[model samples]
Target: MSNESGHTEKLGIDDCTVPETSVSVYEALYRRRMAWDFRNQPVPRDALDRMLATAVWAPNHRLTEPWRFFIIEKGSAASEKVAGLAYDFALQRSGGEQRAAATRDSLLKTPVLIYAYSTPGRDEEGTKENYASVCCAAHNMALAGVAEGLAVTWETGGPTRHPDLAEALGAEADWTLTTMLSVGYPAENPRSERTPVANFVRWLD
Candidate 1:
């Protein structure tokens, strides 16, 4: 395949050593976390652009690049409308004014919101693969955020997947809404644990 410099390079197995860089890929993978608390400051546009650039590199079967991204900035009319929709959805689900208010407040606090989605494919299997590719693309953006010293979280629920919000964001009705990324500067550090790989792995001879 042709590389960035317009040189054709054959793809083949190479050494296992990490590439030389200020931040290693493994470090980014390890440091990536779902950030809930944010500093309420706007993230740099360049940082977000970097994240989107990496997102397009996600692998997809048959190379059906189907991922799409939408950004919502804080304090904008769009943001206010989104929060209002979330409030309405929450009120319907919980039937509590306090809970609905809390949901609106939480969304308003977010500095930036990124919605990732996938375009439908030709058939059922193709559509499923496209959805998976979009998911990978979203994770790529999250990892890129970590490397850029930004916080990111993938959020999805009734409020986020609401059709009204999707229409407001100009997403097509037929496309799938994968997840929304809440991006900002970190206000807190959170830690989590994962089950051992051996617990879920199987060896086949």
Candidate 2:
């Protein structure tokens, strides 16, 4: 029997799925949401790899595929020591309390810590276009995570924008860390309510 706490089941095949052929574009647009409150249980690496692989398939203006993804596995981190030390340094400089430090540790050491960066001015129109492209990539990644049964949260925080942190990761000088993607199983499932699309769309000639 499954647990009744809205947090049972693993995030691999134990998750749910929708038919690729059955869903329409509008339906997909309506389906996406930002999932937070991830479970303590880690998402499997193989599943994450598959979802990220699918995320890069979004359309790009130059076919540049300008985005770069950084993933850190929970309970098996590659940069935990560095990230922890960085958190301490940041707290000292910003005069932030322990709660902020705790949040930083949780985010930086989550099951998947994805940094999506893109070179500035690569998209021609302006920084906005470059950012838009990266945003599209992020949305693709989030949707793919959802399809894989992972709960994800996209966080834009001070660390993501820090020049020193970017340098430590060896991110390119022109690359902006637009957002950090966290992936894991849902800690709790809460139904979402959204404004009707009719409020936003228009058919003008």
Candidate 3:
């Protein structure tokens, strides 16, 4: 009936519009891309605070609110461990040291690593829905990061599944990392490209 004091809203990810004059919702989504290149500059603590403020607005089913965050600050000891794990994950997945080095550097280049976790304890359908919600929450965080003058990516195949790594990030036994965000300033502007929206949409009316 009511909202979380100040967080409740009807705006959903599917309800954004292009920013022709201002940074419209559609424009933000359209402009959003997985940032692979991040500048060495540090993200301000206040700015990250704002990003987290916006991230919790994402929609969830039953308000289970299974979302929890693990912030790996760039210079922190925990952040260094994840960086090493990322390098190992890259080597194992890509089968080479070049890629592993790149992954290690990529994780270390950014100033913040916001690990997104989901608490799972239900059937397949519930698990699927909760993940969907988690992803939506991450998207909001990414866009919020951009809007706050930063770049972010939802990394799904990094070192999240490593039980030891997750424990290092202070996750519970049941909470799994669905995504990790390496966020910072743009080292270089990304090339613009995307699949046409019409290819993925249809008018039913």
Candidate 4:
């Protein structure tokens, strides 16, 4: 199926293709949270693919589609290397051997580590837009993960900005690391409180 713009529509188990259910989108949005504790079970590949598929559909200025994702699946060689890198980074940041060991264990145990990035654009403004676009994409993935019964934690820390880690990932010098998402089944139910919208929202009119 083609839209008015002549782009062929793709079908999947995402929000658009699936039949409407009793679950509302708002519920998914609210259910999405930063999960710190996760089960050791790996997320299904098809579920991860669906989350990424929904992510790419996020709105971007001029349709630049600047987002890129690097997934480190559990038990892969790359995953081991990245986990070591994460351990070293944590050691540097924490300066504690025990903490670093725990950090490394967590990194190794997580079922999936997704490194989201945005390629630099022509100029500063374009680059900024690219970052914004990828951020939206990450949010889309987070929401989709929640819908798929997965826990997702979006993290941007020293490891994500470490030069050695970037080199290990073979990232280009111009590519900006936006965030890293750790996804798996939740081991603990974390509750969060948010301020009322009226506290932050203002009427323009």
Name the best candidate (by lDDT). 1
lDDT of 1 at 98: 96
Cα displacement (Å) at residue 176, model 2: 1.0
Worst 10-residue stretch by lDDT in candidate 4? 12-21
Off by over 4 Å in 4: 1-16, 19-22
Collision pairs in model 2:
none
Model 4, residue 87: distance off in Å is 1.5
Off by over 4 Å in 1: 1-21
Tens digits of per-residue lDDT for model 4 on 130-170? 99999999998898887788888988975565568777887
Please tell me which model should have the higher lDDT, number 1 or number 3.
Answer: 1
TM-score of each: 0.88, 0.74, 0.80, 0.88
Scored by Cα lDDT, where does model 3 land? Answer: 0.76
Worst 10 residues of 1 by lDDT: 11-20
lDDT of 4 at 29: 88
Give the C-alpha lDDT of model 4.
0.84
For the record, the alpha-carbon RMSD of candidate 4 to the native fold, in angstroms, is: 4.0
| Residues 60-122 of candidate 2: C-alpha lDDT, one tens digit per residue | 676556678766666544456436655765676777777558756776556667778876773
Could you tell which candidate, 2 or 4, scores higher by TM-score? 4
lDDT of 1 at 114: 90
